[model samples]
Target: MDVFIFQLSEFAQLVFETTWLPLVIWTVISFGVWFFLQMFENVHPIYQYHTRLALIFSLPAGLLSLASIHYISDWITASAGDGLTMITVISPIDISFTQVEESSGIPFMVIVQSLAVAIFFSGMIFFLIRFCMHAINLKKLRKSLNYRPISEMTSLSPENRGLALATGKNVQVAFLNSEIIPVTFGFRKPVILLPDTLKSQPEKLNLALRHELTHITQHDFFSHLMVILTEAVFWFHPLVHRLKRELVEYREMRCDNIVLSEASVSRKEYASLLLELIPMPNLNKELSVNMAQESSNLKKRITMITQQSKTKPIPKQTSLILLGVIFISTALAMACTDMQTQNVFDEEELDLMTNIDKTGEQGFHEIIIYMSEEEQAERHESKLEQLRMLEPEHIESVHVWKGD
Candidate 1:
């Protein structure tokens, strides 16, 4: 159990170290862009939405790149004769658990590190379980509601039917007898769940359909799923939650913008529709995009609908260039940070020792030593003698294990 916990701690430390720089870069880039957007006006909501989405997935990509670079650089250093070893040198010696404990019970840092990792994994599991529960609720909600295909609804006029078809062939729409607000969800088979009350009022129902269909057209459901997954993994980060909220706001605003651009309904009437739905209860919102989910964003959505400017849309090239700059800057920052951490190699050496320990047979005392492959090939015996001599005074017996 101790070994197991220690292994978990080591794994956690490695992951945290590998990801810390990228995570920091992500937060800085996300919040900096979000704050800038807050200060400005009329920066096309779709542009804002895409920007946040890119940042959402960038952190993981950056971490993978960083790991690849780190290992590749190490290999290049070894091949170029930069004094780094290519293979781990392992020489085992008899070192009893008693002697090891008496000399140093356990490093204080190791226990503390293990505790921290335990807490992190616990929180992650808790959030993951919550996400699963929400999914189950969504399943139940789908089954319990009395629903029928929107196509079968007699009240859908020709225009509304055309809009529904244009949304997508895979998109599913249903009018269900429920008190909850209209919501959009699903990935392969996207769904729009509308309240049955809208059946008697064709105009309001059409407006609701437009809003939910706009969500499907923009692929907000997939975005919502990705963001929720991110939130579950990074449940501890405040910036992650903030990112989620920002995406929600921007996507909804963008959806509203698209609906308004069609000019099928006046802004005043649309805003009034939003007002009527503002207080409706939301169900499984994290898994779905609930129209008018909260009061604060509801206020912003209404404000944008009523007061938006006819600003020229940002060119795609410009947006890509800006995103490229942010990504490049983040990479550079990570490189600089890595250069400053000289002890990272030592930590990796310790990891190799831990791995060697894992292979110890029961009832056998073992001491694992790490050396460069080059050193072992050249001055194997002399280096081995020197390392053995350098072994701690407390070690009474010595047995070395060498690999060919």
Candidate 2:
């Protein structure tokens, strides 16, 4: 239960001081890929299949983040350390902008660690809310549906069923008695759900199935699932949105291309179908495609279909080149996972600091205090004041380990 409630990134950072570094590595990978790809005006067809290509290039970032949890910093005792002189500065938080020296790593760590934790928890919470909402919506919608058969489909069903069959999944087409727009739902035994409005205008059936079956062939439901998870994980990052938008548009275009390839389907009719469905209610189920429901992109999608935009099959060499670039860049970023950190302090300053222990019995501290059960049970707001009221002799020593 705690796993679902509390933030995990804090515990991860506590164990590995440099655990936040992986997020930096990921930001670089995401941004660099997006920037370079955006600069190319005519991206080859290999990359125009952007949905798969983007995930292939970007998902390894998760592995890098997972590896960061294990990054441990080994500490060395100030007395045993050599050469470095003690020049005590203020605490990390008090560090001024003028303190440009690389020796003051505290300020840098403070800012980076805080930002990383903030982003991590924020994204997690956002993703959780969205996930739960989708779950509830899917359950409600699925219950409202009554089972139906492929044999009962309209005249347009045969060609669409043939296309679905080519994907080698036994497809079921059903009538969803809801105001929700056309969608392809389910997995394993997938169902393409058409709004009952379609039952009246049977001619619209071919256009709808061709579009939905094209989605089936493209395996779009799985892709939507993957992107949503990625969005939840990388919610605070800008590139996550960019990647999402890119994937959504490209997958839809790819389906349009597939459907338009059929001689029987006319470009004007396909565009008309999109225009027809835009005003209806929209629905996005987890792992489902709501065809013609996106109002903002409706015009753009219609244009793409009507224009019959065509591109050449990418030469094998170009694909290899792009793949190699992404591979090398990702590998370099992953290597940063092993970066080590250490806390360094001057030996001379340490001697003056622990002057109370000349006998060297315990170099760190000579006094200790234990809180009474009643005191421990006090509210946290009053506990500190209670501790302050205690005399110096009763003060506690909180020994922090600086192990090497």
Candidate lDDT (C-alpha), each? 0.70, 0.59
TM-score of 2: 0.62
Worst 10 residues of 2 by lDDT: 87-96
Error of 2 at 131 (Å): 0.9
In model 1, which range of ten residues has the least summed lDDT?
A: 355-364
Candidate 2 lDDT at 350 equals 32
Error of 1 at 222 (Å): 1.2
Model 2, position 320, has a per-residue lDDT of: 53
Write candidate 2's Cα lDDT for 21-55 as tens digits.
54566667667666776787356434655523554
Candidate 1: tens digits of C-alpha lDDT, residues 69-125: 788888787677636654443444445455453545556777888888888889889
